[model samples]
Target: MKRLHLICLLLAVCCQEITAQYRVAVIGSSTAGGTGAWPLDSAWVRRFNYHYKHQLGIVDSTYTLAVGGYPVYKGMPGSYVPPPDRDGPDHNNNVTKANAVLASLPVPANAIVFVNYPSNKYEQYSIAEIMFCLQTIYDSVLKAGHRCYIITTQPRTGGPFDDPAVKRKLAVIKDSTIQRFGVANTINFYDGLYNPADSSILAKYNSGDGIHYNNAGHRELFERVLAKNVFATPLPVKLTKFIGNYSNASIALQWTAECTDPNTSFTLQRSTDGRNFENITVLKAKGLRSSLYEFTDRQPSPGKNFYRLRISETASLVMSNVILVKNPQEGLQVKGLYPNPVNQPDLEAELLSAQTYSGIVTVLNTAGMSFYRKETNFEKGLNKLIVPVQFLPHGQFILCIRYGDGNSILRTFSK
Candidate 1:
């Protein structure tokens, strides 16, 4: 049986490698799991997948399971009571509501299950309850035969934050469990991104509204968490403008370029109210080459529009500025994504030129999902994978894929 299991694992991996595809997921609570790839397109998960394709040369079939108002294991401990007006009738219960949302999805192949273990609720419950919830989620994922990643929940409770208490509490749960189990998969969300003193990266990531990010906040989140490839590099790009498409359901954009990298293309993102944005789509360019280029955001909606082009490091340590999508909902730019976006799977690129290459992709969210999977030879170019969108509720996302030579590319799209 062990041999058979090993063989199955090998086969599963082989199929993905050959196709260069993936079906990944993001799971957790509100800020960490909020809908729309805030820093990216609709959610960080989707953005992670896109970055995978652009930089690491992988495709993505991504899903997100983060929801806005649900806490983890409410009866346990530190869980806070959302304002009665905000939480509505059944806001008190925690995982019960989240589980209902998760239960509806088609679990993906080689699923990446991210759970916010021992959240603020752990503060209220005894260590035992916190441990029980942790074990339950772990065992459940193991039983389902999926790979589980345990990231210490982000700093939830920075004072005057949405719930500084909640953030601090979750941090405690993360540290305690890591010490007890000595689990290698455990992550460091605080040092990696949050303000150590405040314990509320969410507040920093959020706008003065105390809920979402301003342009500055969004950019910070992108810089800290966005994964970069160690091998691949993007060609030089100069985006000239970003404007809303009032006539069409899209945004209008243009750019100029020169380069030495293997692939050349532009990934566009849009936002409502200017603070949060979604990876609308990607515009492909014939690779191992360059020239001036122009594109449009045909997916314009009836609202304020924010636009940006993820400028790849055509050389090194080089990035670009954000352009506005003046009129959203204009053209055929992919818009209004579902619970899980980034429909493309991982891809493996074959540069006609002898350029360094990489294929590492990571999916993340505000719910504290971090790290990417290192995959080689995922599939030939353009292979597709059907992934579950059960990571979090509908929201913003990004796909950050790093190459083999210390270069990364980002693509934002919506879920």
Candidate 2:
């Protein structure tokens, strides 16, 4: 009888280990950073973490990489440099950095990521720009092999946020965020907190500063996140490795999966802009406990190629981590422009060079009129050229770079 009891106990332990909770990472601004909530413990993120660990009967870990008064720009990738007027990325709070940190842990692959930036950039950035930033962050999170939940913009009172036009724009942003990420993947932070009359934070939920929420409001936010039931679905497969190598005019991709179901299917997808992906090929799982897959792309995009795998099981679908393979040639090449749809005074161009060469960078108008020109030298490997566009009129312009070897590149940007 004791031996049978011991066997049952071991089985119970194994089941507990298999059913471990999800690891969560939150990248957000002041609200998520616990700014408005008095005593901090009442903050939504903290409350969520507490409920997950205590009420849920499991020790799910939650990591918050939020900073006070930070906008979407500050939470961008570390390599991303904001336009001249904006602040650069904060590595500690950046979404890319947070993803990396979470990935290094020995946790389940289906980590939960929360992106909450509420009304931080309403005055400084246009709705389009704000959407772009949010989309970039969301894509990055998805590419990192995690589930992302974007929190909608909450209402803010006083200052410029009270303007009817600004409120309308904020509403547009909130709706756009939901429409873009889908309702299932978004946490509604604006529903009960905002007053319908003026679109400002309700008095009961306001933290008295008019910008953030109090303990009651934070509780409401926590409730919204809980209502999503993001943790209900169980991950069907585990992707152990997803990597790529570039060589001999072709790129080779390989990935390994563990504990995959026999009905699983893998769809190899490629992207040039990292936002829109096109399917390359699809393969069925080998119906093994562990499996390895490989593919090669003979004709990769000239510059950077982004690759990811969509693993579809009978009940669950997930994406592998995005791998970037640069296909560089022997001459001067213009990679791309940063902060596209330029709003700041200065625009930066990323260039890759095989050998040291002198280059002339020029900004030309639509009618071929030279608006700005600069003569600069590019060293071998990657180079960045900053083109001043403050003087250029508000319109679309072309950037042309003429190398000493007679190789020229042309790219377009907007002011």
Candidate 3:
């Protein structure tokens, strides 16, 4: 049997060697510090340490740098006061504290840092402001060449001094942005605790005060983190082929993998526009051996169809490369714009249509905000449209074509 040389295809895949020791760091405030949870060992952080060891077989060294009552953002004048202990060398500056905490570790590389901070008290800071602080700390850790994870603010009870509206708003703000940083890099504590209907922390999980967790609460958090299995050392699964092709008004995807884990499954997902995706189906592994898998979409949407797979095992989620299938048989199809690195304000897009249609062209920034929008008509067959972008400032932008037939194509270009 020919063994698939899968390692070469993976980009810097990290495998645990016999001599390698992986470190896990927990950086947050009292919430992550195990505050209100008796005998700190029962704190979620400590529970995570146990799971990392037995579940992942990692020589995990766990460290916590949580200052009780610390705010993730710097204190604003006349709004909130810094914790008394903030005067220490770390200064309670989230970025400074994170850097110091990480630097103090004996082994920094190959380390995963989980940052959790409660936003209950910081009513003055908007979600965007808090996100900026979290991003700063995240960047600092990344600059040091380590993987960093951020936790969304958990549900809390509004207190007399604490404004209920602000706490809820901040929690939501944190939840939305942290996940966007990286889907795999975030530990979603908010979802595990917040009541979906009321947007409050579930009563059972909430410590009577509504800000912290009880034993059961901590345990629930521990379970969610364990479910992610991010700490698990990856087992190499080589993929020799991953291809998507259009045929007979359908799109078919096929891939071959060599893996020894029997408890593996592949979730095939499809997307019309590249950004949002929907699961098509799931394929389970035949056994702890090599296998070939295939899926066909009988009725794919017109225009560009994107396909990707999420591979799951006992402890990891691996993403496959995205493949595109272009079908210009029924709906409007827009091809790439020329001279993408445009030096001038004039840009052109190539459009292909099977029927007459009209649609809008929108240009968005990195923030997903539309700065330029215009409606245009497409004739049956091929058509070229010239767009004027000279009014836009210098930066990157996404061009999207939304047709009347509920078909759209998106492409990113710079000017």
TM-scores of all predicted structures:
0.39, 0.52, 0.49
Ranking by lDDT: 2, 3, 1
* Tens digits of lDDT, candidate 1, 1-415: 9999999999987876665343444555554453323454544444455665555554344455555644444322123343443322233333333333334334433444555432434445555556666555555555555545555544444333446566656657666777754554454444434543444455546455444444444344434334222223343554444443445454556565554455545666665434344577776654544455566655454335566666544323333455544432211112223333444343222222112232455555545465244443223233222233445345555555554333454544455
The residue-by-residue lDDT of candidate 3 on 197-233, one tens digit each, is 4456778877777778888889867765765666555
Candidate 2 residue 294 C-alpha distance from true site, Å:
58
Q: Which ten residues in a row have the lowest lDDT in candidate 1?
A: 347-356
In model 3, residue pairs whose N, Cα or C atoms come closer than 3 Å (at least 3 residues apart or on different chains), thus clashing, are 6-238, 157-210
Best prediction by TM-score: 2
Q: How does residue 275 of candidate 2 score in lDDT?
A: 36
Q: Report the alpha-carbon TM-score of model 1 versus the true structure.
A: 0.39
Number of clashing residue pairs, candidate 3: 2
Shift of residue 392 alpha carbon in model 1, Å: 57
- Residue-level lDDT tens digits of model 2 in 333-394: 77878778998889988888765566788999889999888877888799988988888888
Error of 3 at 399 (Å): 36
Candidate 3: segments with Cα more than 4 A from true spot: 1-17, 36-39, 54-57, 74-89, 92-109, 160-164, 235-415
State which candidate has the highest lDDT.
2
Could you give me the TM-score of model 3 versus the true structure?
Answer: 0.49
**Per-prediction CA RMSD (Å):** 24.1, 16.9, 14.5
